[model samples]
Target: MSTNFCETATRVLDIEAKAITGLKTYINQDFNDACQLFFNTRGRVIVSGMGKSGHIGNKIAATLASTGTPAFFVHPGEASHGDLGMITQSDVVLALSNSGETEEILKLLPVLKRLGIAIIAMTGNPDSTLAKLADIHLCARVEQEACPLGLAPTASTTAALALGDAIAVALLEARGFSADDFALSHPGGSLGRRLLLRISDVMHDGSQIPLVDEQATISAALLEISRKGLGMTGVLNAQGQLAGIFTDGDLRRILDQRIDIHQTLIVSVMTRNCVTIRAEMLAAEALKIMEQKKINALMVVNAEKVPVGALNMHDLLRAGVL
Candidate 1:
């Protein structure tokens, strides 16, 4: 009577995987019609479902909304109450019900039709009432459920979820959705921080910037770097333009040569023609440059190469772009 749990789990995964693969054949003209319906709609894509289908519907709606096809979910039961008001004639309906005969969902069909809202149906039974009533039926039919007793919504729900993801991705491509657009929809997440943040938003600027005159001694640059805590100092010429840069790494290199930090001028040892970035450039771009060039810090400048700000790996880490 001992149950082999691992064996059962593996079998369940295989069954679910096969069920999702079966959805490939169903992606025919009906799939295209569904995508077109979602893409052409000026208003939101309203998704509704019952039971387990409702959970999948919520995720599907979220995916569509984040991927540039504005959508939201309304429980079929709630839609029968007052949530139906959330949907308008301009919006399209995506209804999910594996059996295609859910009473709650079927109840809304007449009202949605009277309003002239197109319905895209996802169900296991293509011949069921919901499928027949829908303007476009996306058959999510599967050979069997992964449940040992052949009752629970296992493989069937997995197949439905995969099909929903496929439609969302197809619509995303058709809508020309980009990563930046996705970031805008997810501003509170790390991806948003990485994509939307600019160098100016995080860099040390004004008096926070470590700066020294080109004629300043190495000791002066070290003091500026220490006081500013940026590990580097921008050396400016008499014309008030960036002449070079001196860093702690430069100090280490010059230290071995026994160059007197108090007497040696910064211009002689500072790195000239150094890498610089614009304040307007994305902070992610700055991270790319730092990784590619094997550097820890960057100077943010303007069109004239005047040092406007400075940032390091620490700044990016704090901003969650790392």
Candidate 2:
């Protein structure tokens, strides 16, 4: 039984892979015109379809919206019942139908035409009504379905989805859509936190910062490190500028030298010219520096190199940037 199941799964995967690969031939001038139309559209790309095609359309619309092309799905069945009002003259309609003759989607063509809305049809049948009437037609043809019976929409839907992703990514590049722009659309996600979170937002500030004067003993710095629990402390000069940093590694080095922590001034044992970051830097940038330098903590400094804040790998982990 397991052998049969594995063989069937492999067959399905092969069929779907071929389906997606075959979609490359369809990426021609029609696809380019569709992408250009969607990119130049001043309003949203209204995506519509029926059944499984509707499901794929929803995902395509979401991908387009997140990737910088404003888009939303309008179910064809729902559009016939009142949702058609959601589309406007400024919008472009992207209709998906494997057979290219889904009754519900085709029914809206006349109205869409009256509204002066251009239609980009994604279908397996290039000669079908949806394709013939559309302003741009993209062929998402598949030789066979992944299903053994060849009745399911598996291969066709996969081809359509891959084509949609290709168009969205093409538009994303044409528009110069960046990771920062993508982050703005997904502010609640980890990517957004990594891109949008600044060092000042996550770093320990003011009283929370682990700090000691250069004149203070290493013992005092250790106490501050313990109190702040960042595994390190910033040592400040007489002018309150960041002079150096003392971390657990420094303590280990001093211990090897048999130096007395109680008598040693922090500046004498601390790592001077320590790598520091600005408060305005992204927390993700701080993580990169820490990883590259093989350090766990950093001192956030002002323009004058005065210590304003402090952060460690733990803080970045807590902030979801790690």
TM-score of each: 0.84, 0.87
Cα-based lDDT for every prediction: 0.92, 0.92
Colliding residue pairs in candidate 2? none
User: Which ranges of candidate 1 are over 4 A from the true structure?
Assistant: 1-9, 178-180, 189-192, 237-240, 253-273, 291-293, 320-322
Q: What is the number of residue pairs that collide in model 2?
A: 0
Which residue pairs in model 1 clash with each other? none
Q: What's the CA error at residue 113 for candidate 2, in Å?
A: 1.9
Worst 10 residues of 1 by lDDT: 175-184
> For model 1, what is the alpha-carbon lDDT of residue 50?
91
On residues 200-294, what C-alpha lDDT tens digit does candidate 1 reach at each position?
A: 99999999998999999989889999999978989999988888888888888887898888999999999999899999888999999999999
Let me know the TM-score candidate 1 reaches against the reference structure. Answer: 0.84
Model 2, 44-77: lDDT tens digits are: 9999999999999999999999999999999898
Per-structure clash totals for the candidates: 0, 0
